[model samples]
Target: MEERLIMDLVPGLEGIPAAESAISYIDGDEGILEYRGIPIETLAVKSNFIEVAYLLIFGELPDRDEYERFKSDVTYHTRLKLKILRMMEWLPENGHPMHYLQAVTSAMGMYYPARDTLDEEVRYWSAVRLIAKLPTIVAASHRLKHGDEPIKPRNDLSFAANFYYMLFEREPLPLVERILDTMLTLHADHTMNASTFSSRVVGSTLADPYTIVSSAIGTLSGPLHGGANEEVVRMLAEIGTKENVRPYIEARLERKEKIMGIGHRVYKTRDPRGEVLKGFIEELIAHKDIDSGVFELSKEVELVVAERLTGKNLHPNVDFYSGIVFNGMGIPTDLFTPIFAMGRVAGWLAHWMEQLKTNRIYRPTQKYIGKRKEPYIPMEERKRATAR
Candidate 1:
């Protein structure tokens, strides 16, 4: 038996190359990010989010013809099934949209059953339906909860713009639309994070794609995972100002409490996604002229926390700045995680497709500690005998 828990195995798992990928490298020490051998900074600055999605799914940047086809396919499938829209309406308004999304995603598998043949055309349609409808479902849920009528998707608009327009019932400002697009591109994929791993594990069993994605969403709903940004926003709100940040962080550090969004399981130094989001947050803040005092306070907290926990090697992750950007975009606090789902579903689908290509059942080994041999005893008889 192993004498101690091997925590370092977190990064280096045998036979699981999913965790480590040269395809998209995150250099945490230097705060650099790259996707498919291209620097993330360049993509964020130059490419639109839909283009990035195409890159992740197809493994190369699409040329004009391929890009047009991809966009057309996505746009054609953006409209939800009428039955699914009715189901969305039946969902409780106050309930978390992620829960609704999970249920809806799982339910989608039932609506679109996989054929025995499993032809390439079938798989292609499945991919299109998932990628296009996900944002529509999420945005519609947002509007539905707020007692507003869900806006129909505009085929002419880009995916990000359509999502924003649907949620707000008006055209988004050009800069805001671009920022949202960049954010979606940045989040389109990462190598097998917890939720992506969950999706892949399910897909390995040859389960329906919707079921796999639903499982992924359930995993991401946890606070330690996708929901951290919501908590980060609340934490910043509680801190209220730059002056309160140091004292608040000091108090939390004294208690050994985790400052939400300040740590990650994979990245040792800094999250590359965090760097991109920090820039977006700054842009949004300046564009909106919202004096939230969050950016200054967050910077102070990051500096002080790094100084305090030297050996822990913790830093602000992607979730740190994402909430601020969402808040700046006029998004409510509760809807943050659901918005994360909008971008993450693409990655989930990509992993699902990859898993299906090399079909295998995922069964992990567990370290069990129990009696090697045990005799069953009659509970009533043993208790009576003991009393006597």
Candidate 2:
């Protein structure tokens, strides 16, 4: 063994980059976003969610025949397995749906036990099942908890349309569907964030994609991670009305508290997704007659907070505007994270497939800080140390 310096990266610690994908790209500093090399604003106005997903997975926009086939295949697989339905029924109504989703996805791996003949075809089908059933599972969990009837998936509608239908048991208005589709595309992927990193870590073990995605979902459930959207909604609700915005933000700044949705790990300037979502909120407010004062309040909060903390280099992220948009769409506050999972599932599956193409077990070493060769003493023999 080489006995490297503490906290140093050993050989092969930094893995090779995967194949070039035409998925979403993040330029954190410039606050620019692109999907398939086209700017996000262009896609938001022209492309739909399904088209974006196909592009991410298959490397380009599908032709008419290919798009139709892809839509049919996904729609056919949208219905949950009977056993999975029963499993959802068994979950407590008060339980968080993300927890239920993580459990169900892990259980799915056991139900469809892995085989020695796991080939590309197997992986492809596994991806299909995961992508198809995720929305159904999330929608069912939402309805079950709220004591509402679960709506069956309609094969004729687009992915975003069907998801809205299942959630509300009615077809969504065209503008609503368009906004949601764009939102999905915007969130489909980014360069290796926390949840994507978690999926890749699990996948590096040559584990099944289902297990990898399940682990990713668990990582995303943390408040500091995927739950930021929920916190944003909560923050807005507490702020109450337009009149309270300034004072509320000023008070928060004085306490030196970090506002949810106001900062990012990768983006030092502004988040491009935040810009896109803000536009969506503006459209929804104007055309849909939705109250978007909360969005204005959030913007004011961003400005005041940034000015006060100058050197902190804070900026509002995607989650900042997403909360207002979802709230305006009449989505319940509790379902925010589950909706985020809906968007992120596509990215997770894509990353998992990419990892399998170059499978390597992830095993990082940690610094050893504990005493070396310490004797194991009986419980009574040890003396308690005084607090410093």
Candidate 3:
């Protein structure tokens, strides 16, 4: 028998290794991120979202024939069931996008009957189905929430372009399409993030892929996680202009409150994905005119914040400039995190499939901090004791 070490308690299980994965690696101290040993920058510049998705879920970059087949499969499965489209209209218009996404994603399991939970081919195809369908679901939900009609999917378009088309029913500019592709690639996987962890935990129970991923979507919906970029955009809007950026930081400093997009939990330096997004923002700036002040305000705020936090080892994460990039793309703020889920579903499915291969239930030992064996007394006796 293997001896288990009695280790010191670490709150939130930070820095704990829960599972072995060959999917992604991050050197937070060096501000590095790689998918299957390929640097994020390389993938951002050289790979589209589908290509990266293949790399993440399959463990290697695909060749031409393989990629073509994968693309074909994904394209073929992009359309939602008629029932799913109708289902979105029933949701309250004011419901948060993440909540709708979570609910609808859970419904996928019911909508499409699973053949086998443990079968390898069944699970892989399930991953492919999710990668293909989440965009349709998100886009359909977007249109339904606003009383607009949903657009059908097109195989001729690239993965990013297809989602753009689905959302607006028009082809995105070439640059915008490419930028969204890189954005999705960058977000495809990280080293066991909160959502991915939730995915693994659920999958450990031998749950179906949709249920596992739905659990992950719920975990990712928190403000501190996937919603951070949405908050960043809101912060920039509140700052209003370059002049106000300084005062805004100073006041937030006085309160010692968190400045959204400024810091991340993992990377003590800068997030590598943030750098790639910043480069894309530069390209976007040169190619188009940004009417919103948020872009300029973000730049000025970054400079000020960087100067102020010189020794704190804090910097803008992926959330920092990503909101500005998406805002400029005309994506609504509420859809920001859902868009994140669309990209991240590939990773969630990857982790889910990986966990199933090992097939161990994730029952972790917890430190008991609450009162132990508190005696239950009769209600009248307890009330009389309280009176006494």
Candidate 4:
């Protein structure tokens, strides 16, 4: 006789492979990640933001013609629709940037209603529009938070440079622009992260790209995901100085409180993204000269934590130095995670496109843990049934 198979249910799908994807790879034990088989560091040093984005969404490097077309398409669509602008203005000035991003992006599906998610032309244009407008929306949200007027997107500038322009209505230094570009590349994609999975799940239902992206942004707003960077910055401020690092870390460790930014759920060793950002932070500190104190404090804290966390496989994840790098670039901590969403929009859309190819609505099984069915009771016996 043939035997039936029994499957074990994993909560949160921990260690379960959800879907097959070729877009990105991660070896958490080895502390390695790659996009389309290209090392992130290689792209970080050599490629610009748009090129890396093209590579991620399309599955390979773009040639000159394709690259130019892709860049032009993104540049042309970079401006927010007047309706989107009005919506931004409608939001409370004090509301969270991520929340505005989520609401506006979801509403885009209503604005530009999609007739099809599986159409190549529709998919391509939707991806381009989301990637192009994300930075603009995020920058506008930041400006609104400060009661400042929104700056229009610039066609002449690169993606990162244009974001900075929209952010401050001023030109970024060449070095800063390049570093910010590199940061965008570093964040462009990761293998099945929270937001990526969220996007894929929504896309599986044949939802339009805008709704899929909005769903991903909502996932990103979670404290355990994208918000960790903002927490890192706040934690550093709470520590205040290098002198306070030791005691603060000791107390946290003794209390078993998490040392935010110091460890990761996936990586067993140091996160390569963290290492890359650390190098950028060091380079930025050298350039700033006068205000390297925060950099020093971060390093001091790392050293103290390193000694205590020796065998815990703990090391600085991407959040550790990314906050510092953004701070060095004159960006506030609150906007850090939203900026992350801007970068990650590429990855989310890529996964969305990929999911449509062999679409299957995500319907995972659950282990039921409720009382077995009881016999139906008459109305007269219902009160006595509850006492059981």
Superposed by TM-score, candidate 1 places the C-alpha of residue 219 at a distance from the truth, in angstroms, of: 1.5
The numbered model that scores best in TM-score is: 3
Q: Candidate 3: TM-score? A: 0.95
Predicted candidate 4 versus true structure: per-residue lDDT over 1-388, tens digit per residue: 9995547777677877778999998888988889999888788888888998899999999999999999999999988888889888989987888899999888888877875987889989988988899899999888887888889999999888999999988889887898888888888898888899999999999988999999999999988788777787888889998899999999998998999888888888869888888887677678854367788888998899999888988999998888877776788778888888888999998888888878889997777878797898889766754655
* Models ranked on lDDT: 4, 3, 2, 1
Off by over 4 Å in 4: 1-6, 375-388
Give the per-residue lDDT digits (tens) of candidate 1, residues 1-388: 8695544443325345653333456665676767777888788888876677777666689999989898899899899888988899999999888888888888888788864314667667777788888888888888888888888999989888898889887878887788778777777777767888898888777777778778998998887667788888888888887888889988987897889888876677778777778776666557654554566677777778778877887888888778777776777777777777777777777777767666677875555658877878888655553654
Of candidates 3 and 1, the better by TM-score: 3
- State which candidate has the highest lDDT: 4
| Better model by lDDT: candidate 2 vs candidate 3 | 3
Q: Write the per-residue lDDT of candidate 2 for residues 1-388, one digit (tens) a residue.
A: 9885557645433333434444567776777777667777777778877677777766678999988877777779999878888888889999998998888888888766543214777776776777788888888889988898678899888788898899999888887787777778778888666788888788777788789889999988888677788888888889887778778888887798768788887678878777778777667757745666666776667677777768977877888878778877887877777778777888887777766666666665676668888899899987879855
Q: What root-mean-square deviation over C-alphas does model 2 reach?
A: 3.6
Candidate 3, superposed: residue stretches over 4 Å from native: 289-292, 372-374, 384-388
Task: Give the local distance difference test score of model 3.
Answer: 0.86
Candidate 4 global lDDT: 0.87
